[model samples]
Target: MISTEQLAGFRYVQDLQDQPAALAATLDSLEASPAPGDMADGIVRGRFRRVVLTGMGSSFHALGPLHLRLIESGIYSLLVETSELVHYLPALVAPDSLLVVVSQSGESVEVIRLLEAAAGTAPVVAVTNTPSSTLARESQFVVETRAGEEATVSTKTYVASLAALEWLGAVLTGAGVPPVLRVFRSACAGMTEYLSGWPAHVESLTRFLEGVDHIFLVGRGRSLASAGTGGLILKEAAHFPAEGMSSAAFRHGPLEMVRPGLLLCVFAGDLPTIGLNRRLAADVSRGGGKVAWIGNDADLDALRVGVSAVEALPLMEILPVQMISLVLAARAGREPGAFVRLAKVTTIE
Candidate 1:
């Protein structure tokens, strides 16, 4: 079994190498494009009472942070799965409403159907890794993710999606984009450096995963997005029943299920929320569950830009989780990214 520390470290480095470049490219593209004013002109100026963000899998989880950002800005934004949006929420949309759809491949059938349903009633904005994909072509506006390619699971693409959506948040709220772009650039640099030692970290984490029956991830805000997506990857790649919940929610209920053989991962985002996450980790540990804290001051300097930048924070933090999933899958003797019962593009109604 690999050590817990090694797995944690490796996952961190993997994110660093990939997320930074994607973020830089995303920001550069946004800067060069037609301003949000031109793209959102008629919709924002003349209409649009509500904004709905829709997607599937990791793409769906990416909406968590932006949903909070929108609500904080007084925009009544809704986060719904594309399948659900198509079958049930069609009536909620109209010509004035804005539908933001995120799909890494841009060719998912449900996304395609959702676009068709929103054809004339609302404006569709597609955020996808494939610029030439069908969904991108069908949407009124498209934001391309520069996450390049993935070997199996959604690694860089997930972070790229988050960075892209955060920029959209700034644009929609009329906040200046320059500041966010600068932060993103710095963050990318930090992410790259943080991931440099990923192999070593993965080696450490393997030990804890050796005989674990389940894994639980907890975080809040943007971290919650990470927690959910990370848990999903752990399940898909490692063939484990991994679960994620907001730290607060776990306290309210899920904490009861933790056990000695269980692995619990807590993502501590910023200073304000770190304590809460850490406390949850402690609770899990006290209950005899194996636990780990992904980010702290000791590792923060190693991931910050300049020396290491704050912009790269998310990338650095997210990488370790991805690596853990990858390593666990390899150790479990399973082919990574093999969807046994699910299709790459979910078309179910």
Candidate 2:
């Protein structure tokens, strides 16, 4: 198990510890700014033919829940990476489409290119941390997340954007804001409670992850947000090799990769497919791979995350993965989230 001494003072760890406060501040910002009522009305009246969601890295993965919510509400939503959206699908940026872009830095190279390519053709709604950035200044609508400055990785900004996106989803779907605000408050409280025991969580994960050389995070439904972002952060922060995919996709081919050194972290996502996720965990364990089932009712205490609403699961589900990253970084004797080659913002496409 990693000692508290080794984990202390890392900027990424500090960022992780700041998530609850950042989340609260983001919620406060959302409450102060009213939802874009005109845009919501336009969507309901079919002023916009479709919603295009795009971002890069964690920002891109963070759109999972919103994309699903938009589709479930009967809106035609396309989830695309900004790089692809800019290079291959510029036609989707027509005036009839609503573009929802998530970027913590707001000024990534692809985002800059996208904004230039868009050239105000579509009404853009940006979920970003930088209020003065090009994305915020040029967007027709903006939801700024108060994640403050993140020195490394995407701990606070990613989660804060999730909160903002959740509120945006509620407004765009005409689901009302009060209920989503309540969920946000509950999720922030849960994050605080969980992070308070960070040391124990890290230690427990250190033991649970013994001899695991690779990881696969799998889930269905909204939990895909965590699975996707979880894989990204694990590699970024710990330099660990990990992959995230839908649970069903795992059964098709990657399931064959299961072996003694492999760790399968399965999210028992929303009830619609929780049974399948649970069965996948069992099968992976039976195949001699280490299995960590992540959910409120997870069999392992180290992997359990307290989830209140299914909507909040995406926010809560990431806590255990954060702990795993700390453990893996400690095992590797490296400072977690210290970027060796990458910059915080992608200046080059």
Candidate 3:
């Protein structure tokens, strides 16, 4: 059994707990702003030829939902990492383009270079927690997360940014801000309710994954936000190596690794692809693999975080992974959020 001493004085757990309040405050701020429909008229009449969404780390992964949101609305959109956008795809930042840059810290190494390399004509729509950041000051528009100061991993900021981006998407698509705003308004209570049982979540996951040597997180669509960000934090928090992949993409080759030492966690995404995701989990279990299914019906149900309403499910999906990181770090006799080398914000490109 792992000891609590292993994780004593760590700020990661507190950061995760603060997400509900942080997210609620963020949504509240956006809701009080000018109605989104009235604000997005410039983008609708083709004044902006395309949208480029760029960020790094969890910020990049959070773009999964927004990228799909734009495509669903018949808007031209490109999702690129900040580093790659400035270095490899400079052509995408043209006079007619709209760059929506998502970064918790507005001054990451890549974000600084993006400003340096930009054509200076693209209207930057900065979505960040830091209002006074370089990215926010230089942008034509700014959307603040208001997730407050985070000392460890990006628990509060990531979810807040996702909610803010969803608001941005709703505005661009003219989806009516009332419905989406209500969804996020309810998200505050839902998140607190789900996270109230954090100890139970940690115990359940730790017991189930006691002997697991490797883990894989799988999902599609909005759930990709969880799948990708979950894997990165696990490795960062616990120094554990895990892989996150699309549910369909995993079967291509990773299926061969379905065995006792490997744990395959699957997210039952939205209706269209959920059946296929469930089938993949079932097949892996039949092959003697350990599987944890996160959905409405499951052994380890993660839906308790937030019910599937609007875009809040993605916000909910990541909570369990945060708990998993805590338990994993405990098992390794290490402190959560203790970075041996990597800085909170990457300063070097």
Candidate 4:
């Protein structure tokens, strides 16, 4: 079993802790960089007709929030899994097209295939932590995340990817980088503050996981990306069964699965979706399922009385799932991050 302490992975969190300063630097550099019209001396944007975002596994799901940002800005972007993008979406490529591919290691098999498929037609932008990586060498434009490194499941790299892509999203739409930088700063501060309260949350959530057999995570917009990625992390770290889907999709059929042994984790995003998420939690609770609401919609205000924004943010939005996974691991007597079969880099085709 992966130990809870081992799962905590102090160095991983420390690396994540160190990311805010690095991310701030990246934002500063990006601000000094030319606008969308100015990238590649303005020649690249003129030839590209569409932006296709591709990756695999967590790398692919990381593109979810960015896709929402692009669509909201009306910049015409597509988020396709790399395998399908290489085989079916080949026709969408042109010299004018922009394909931004993300990989932590810059070595996923599908990412390599997609790069090959986009070879001549679309100019490639590779976002990676490794500058010497294969993807970086092949890309016409490369955005290095500068996350330093990561261990266990992706902590800093994923956050850095979000920060980097969010900046690019703003650039693609001709928006100032400061606003994006502001949000990243807030998120970082929130996450940093959130970790302090983990010990208590871990203790309290054990009861919720006592007999739960299935867990479902739902979100929409940018929250959806976190919800899905969160689900994957819980599965990977705790060796549990977890499902991530859209909030609307929960209503269509999955809501029926709510029962005494089921757990529903919903991420409350901005505005209307927040209300919808609360209602979903209520729905699950009404059906006798255990419901843990994260984000602003959760009723943690009573417990959150003395918490700071940094501490509150992760508890409200990020740490609950981590706590829940920890609880589940304890109940199953499993170690937190005991990887038996999966390797860090997925080399197989």
**Model 4 lDDT at residue 308:** 29
After superposition, which runs of candidate 1 have C-alpha atoms over 4 Å from their true positions? 1-17, 38-46, 298-314, 338-343, 347-349
Each prediction's total of clashing residue pairs, residues at least 3 apart in sequence or on different chains, is 31, 0, 0, 11
lDDT values, one for every candidate: 0.73, 0.91, 0.83, 0.69
Q: Give the TM-score of candidate 2.
A: 0.98
State which candidate, 1 or 4, has the greater lDDT: 1
Best by lDDT: 2
The candidates, ranked best first by TM-score, are 2, 3, 1, 4
* TM-score of each candidate structure, all chains considered together: 0.87, 0.98, 0.95, 0.86
**lDDT tens string, model 2, 155-252?**
89999999899899999999988899899899999999989889888877777889999999999988889999999999999999999999999999
Cα error, residue 340 of model 2, in Å, equals 0.4
Give a tens-digit lDDT track for model 3, residues 162-207.
Answer: 9899989988888877888788878778789878777777777778
Model 2: residues >4 Å from true position, as ranges? none
Across 296-334, the per-residue lDDT of candidate 1 in tens digits comes to 543323222232333334455666676677667667665
* Candidate 4 residue-wise lDDT, 1-349, digit = tens: 3354654665433543455555555556565655445443333345556688888766777788778767776667788887888778778666766888999999878877777777776788888878898899988878778777666566567767777787777667677778777766665555555556665566566654677898898877766776777788788867889988898999999888888988888776666566877788887899999876676435653123122232112223545665666677767776654566777777777
Residue 255 Cα positional deviation in candidate 2, in Å, after optimal superposition: 0.6
Highest TM-score: which candidate?
Answer: 2
Model 2, global lDDT: 0.91
Alpha-carbon lDDT of model 3: 0.83
